[model samples]
Target: MAEPFPLAPSLWATTAPPGPETPPLTESGQADVVIVGGGFCGLSTALHLAERGIRPVVLEAREVGFGGSGRNGGQVIPGLKYDPADLVAKFGPERGERLARFAGSTADTVFDLIARHAMDVPHRRAGWIQGAHTEAGLAEVARRAEQWAGLGAPTRVLDRSETARLLGTERYLGGWLDGRGGAIQPLSYARGLARAALKAGAAIHGQTPVTGLSRSGSTWTVTTAQGARLSTERVVLCTNGYTGGLWPGLAQTVIAANSFQVATKPLSDNLRRSILPEGQVSSDTRKLLLYFRLDHTGRLLMGGRGPFREPRTPRDWAHLERIVGKLFPQLDGTAFDHRWCGRVAITQDYLPHLHEPAPGLLIDIGCQGRGVGLQSTMGRAIAQYIATGDADSLPLPLTPIAPLPMHAFHRLYVSAIIAWYRLSDGGIR
Candidate 1:
């Protein structure tokens, strides 16, 4: 067996109090719902259900937000990983408009929840800039901005000078600024969601891995590795990237890719003021994108493509450091305060999936790289679906579940494609 990756200590570790760690299910118990995975989706769903007087039991293999929910770039930018145009092409214009609205409104939902729950996750609606690193990329960014504006979003296209003024880098030609987008401390947000769920009367069990799941009559029996079992009327699988092997078919449809990030020591006031004067999170528009933002402590957190396959040691944090230096040469030689990596699930079409694998079974996975904002929206949708059996409440279209063709070859295929993109970025045609 591969050794488990070391859990990097996060700033949130010091901020939020530890959540309650319920002992693993020991004997057969019963509940209204059994939720798998304690990340944002599971926790948010539990909270919603609890509010509606439905008690839910959440089982998490690791601590809450132990997956991408806690370790993401924290860029709560709007929209899905795939383009809105593509979604419109796939689904009709009306459904596509609704999906777009859901994606765009996701940021509001996140910030609203933080406010209503008094969750101190250092959230800032500082807007976000989608930088364009090349001439073609710049044109595309302009086109996208126009499309968004036409769709009633408040987006503006910025020239090279404006881009440089906002980003403190000459690396990009131009970009788009979407005021609706923002950033947050991801782990803190996840923990806040857990606290909210707990306060709402939901039970969350950490360090409890579900070993076996079997259908018994109208109820589903969930057995934990530690000799505990729960018989529930409904089962929700919100495992996402850290799904482990619970549902093999769902796992096959999504590839777990590792994304790494490094944070520098707090920047000097002068440098911090100049880089992001407006306090907006920024990301470049490359196939393998580079995302960065100033944390609550004024440190520069930079992240990009990395660890293409499984989560393993010997991470290339140095590569991230070099990239950061290239983007801000003045920050060269600055000591990094932390380096970490996490896995994100990417689907074939680069979209999230909500599937009904069996009766009373609802599996939601594949957020690609945009789970932070979308997860909450998905949680609300799932809760409504479970409560009223209405698929129309979902944010994204619920298409038929089609597993990836030739699943075993994903690693090789993804690695090669990533290498090609890297080489292209390096000016190799």
Candidate 2:
């Protein structure tokens, strides 16, 4: 067996053993759709398809949510990773409005799923605050809030005092708040989605790695390492970051970047109250952003960009500890109980893609860092497209597959870009 990815620790390993281990495709099987990956996108698509009387078989390399879906910042934020205006500029006004509405509703879709499935993920609707690290950043947030409000979304601009009151910290200049945003225990949510999909009559096979795939006369035959195969009418690829060469062209379109997070030991009531008075998730408006929130137990969870690839040393924990202390000086001595990192799929345009490279094949990946909410919305759209073959219903624009230029040089470019952005954020531009 291949070694597991380093970023994903076994801290939140699935408590409920995966739905019995699925034997490799020794004998050929058939299904309406054969989905690859058991994360949010795959699970959500399977659940929706099952509800529509289409039972899909999901193949997983490891357990469900074993990838980035299981270990993320857990911030259920609204909107796509890119600016709506940029989307409008790329597409047009009418299509842009439609996409904007869809992006804004991503968070609502996540909450709805949690409620409908009764997923015990400790979800909350306390909203999210986009903290501004500088005055210009605060103004930019205000302008964004105004624009979103103009589009009839629930957004509010906050002043410095208001920001401090809401976040319980004076580190920020000001920011915007959207009531639709919230947080979740992501691993639990992903597992809950898997359970819900299974209850809806979808077959999820864990530890069944898809080694290869071939087109077979209007259908697809997906093969596992054990020489087992499954023929399905359609295929959906939802493997986000751990998509290690599954599809030839798929990996070229997105850059895999590492993101790290550290969780401090549960805080005392007084410290918790002094840190996050409103229990809302918060992220600063920086290129290499800092996102933090207080979990149910009042533990401060902070996450930000890690090294270009993955960190390979125990000293990475010390780096994260220093960052946490720098951000919240009051928590300098707090012991960190958990530290982990995960990969995020970033597209060239900073927007997600829902592409159909061939008939009966759908791909939904490149969520950037906004997969928590975006996955649910995109998953539903994918299910709709799979059922009706109407690509227009997708939350994002469906365009030709275009690989990023100089794909192999992404690590060097990303490193320079991140460093430049960090300097710009510090007023060095």
Candidates in order have lDDT scores of 0.83, 0.81
Model 1: weakest 10-residue lDDT segment is: 307-316
Query: Candidate 2 residues 298-397, lDDT tens each?
Result: 7888887767867766566565577677766778799987778878988888888777787788888887888988887888888888888776878666
> Residue by residue across 287-371, what tens digits does model 1's lDDT show?
8888899988888998877757544554467778888888887787888878777888888877788888789988898877878
lDDT of 2: 0.81
Using TM-score as the measure, which candidate wins?
Answer: 1
Clashing pairs in 2: 25-228
